[model samples]
Target: MSDTSGSQTNITDGQQVQLLERVSVAVVTTLPCCVFLFINVTMLFTLRSKPVFCETSRYVLLYNLLFADTVQMALGHLLYLFAACRLFLTYPVCGLLILLACFTTTIAPLTLLVMSLERYVAVCYPLRHTTIITIRNTGVAIVVIWAFSSLNILTRVLLLLEFPFKDLESLQMKEFCSGVYVLLGPRSKDYDRAFICVLFVSAGVAISFSYFGVIIAARSASTDKASARKALNTLLLHLVQLCLILSSTMFDPLFMALSGILTRIVFVRLYRVLYIFISLFPRCLCSLIYGIRDQTIRPVLMQHLCCGFLKPAVSNSK
Candidate 1:
């Protein structure tokens, strides 16, 4: 009797520990997510609040990129919360959420590619930058990016249709909803891997070309030394951001690989760490990089972020 009682106590203690861990993980992730979401939302508002932001081509691209990242971050967090809470969604429902997340995920790198090229044009062809990087052209690029991403989503939907959904006892998922779990077959996985590889590789090449093109242009005596230097710095930042985004994509596979080796407790701890840094942090980088670094954006973004507190100070100074 004593032994049985002790075993029950042990099991109860273990369950309590797990509950504590889950709550801690949720708090840690949720707090940062809420903070970043606020900043991104503020930055988005700041972008649209001013005529300069709306009229400029790069700002238009930044708006589109930030919009995509904001959506991706929100959806990603929602999905993470659902999984943490052990909320099992229907296949159709889960697929929709994952597809939306995936859709936005593709936009970041592609927009970065365009942004890099825009910088390249600004440096290499200063005379024609206005002609080449017009607001109309920027809008068309945004449209093309969305259309390309939609086509990818459409292909995934078709692949999902091939799944034997009717054979299942119900539409309700048997496990936590994730991109890997939602993939109904090997073919889906293969196509996904292939698509991601192609997309990132192509974007990387284009961005790298732009980076080098800027470097070569910087060497020319004709180029504005200050402008070329700034573009080079921006290109370098873009490269780092791209690498971070690429690392975030590896989280799923990394977790899957580590799961088989690590005990559940260890795996859970590792997962929280990886998800925080790898998945969540990258989504917030755009706001941090652009909001703080850009001279034009910094003051306005700070004003919005501080809820107009800075406005009085600026007026007083002026």
Candidate 2:
């Protein structure tokens, strides 16, 4: 009887492990990779097909934002897929992935900041907006944003390198991926938290102010109520996008803190599920929002989807 019970227990444990692996691979790896790839490629095609759409300053900025999001998905979530599949990555390769992820993640919020400011100028100072938010200036702003974000992440990467990787080989052998599990000293951890908090707060404040300015301008422009209402709706959409992007970043430290306190298997599983949803869902949401919400892109997207899917059937019938 004792031997039978022990065997049953072992079988149960094995089944549970297999189930967890399957779930993780599906949610974290396969679904996100396919969704991100499809959305980003579709967005690029839609945007690039029209020269006039690409020439507009607002769409140009949005194109850059989409580009940044695509890079972020590639560097961050795509690597999560590799990790989910239990692929082995070298220390240098892992570090480089981390650096690229950090760089792209940082660029996203800053690009949104630029977008908000562009909207602010367009709504508040319409007469000067053409001069202020021209394609050349927008291009310069993108360059500056990228340069700043890259430098910030480069510093963090350097700081990260100082941590000992003595057990990295053993860890990789066991887990088959690094999984962003670098151990930082207390001071280093504190600095990281501080940096993240500051960045979040600063960007959040700037976005808020830009939206507020747009609102004020809208209210004052009594002659152009229709345009004001449209601008307001667009700003609201942007706010939703902002929240989704922030959801990916803001929840991580909190989850890390919870993991330290609640060290249960269930808690770990819940965290994995939540992380997969929060991180990957936003990329899909952002792409969908842009494709559906943008006047210039929406028709183009519909046309492409219709032709891509229906043309094959029509051809076969002929």
Worst 10 residues of 2 by lDDT: 309-318
Maximum-TM-score candidate: 1
Clash pairs (backbone) in predicted model 2: none
lDDT, candidate 1, at 147: 97
| Model 1 TM-score relative to the real fold | 0.92
Q: Give the local distance difference test score of model 1.
A: 0.88
| Residue-level lDDT for 162 in candidate 2 | 79
- Candidate 1 wrongly placed segments (more than 4 Å): 1-20, 312-318
TM of each candidate vs. truth = 0.92, 0.80
Q: What tens-digit string does per-residue lDDT give for candidate 2 at 43-151? A: 8777788776667787777777888788777666656565555577665667677667767777877887888778777777778888988889989998998998888
Q: Candidate 2, residue 174: CA error in Å? A: 6.3
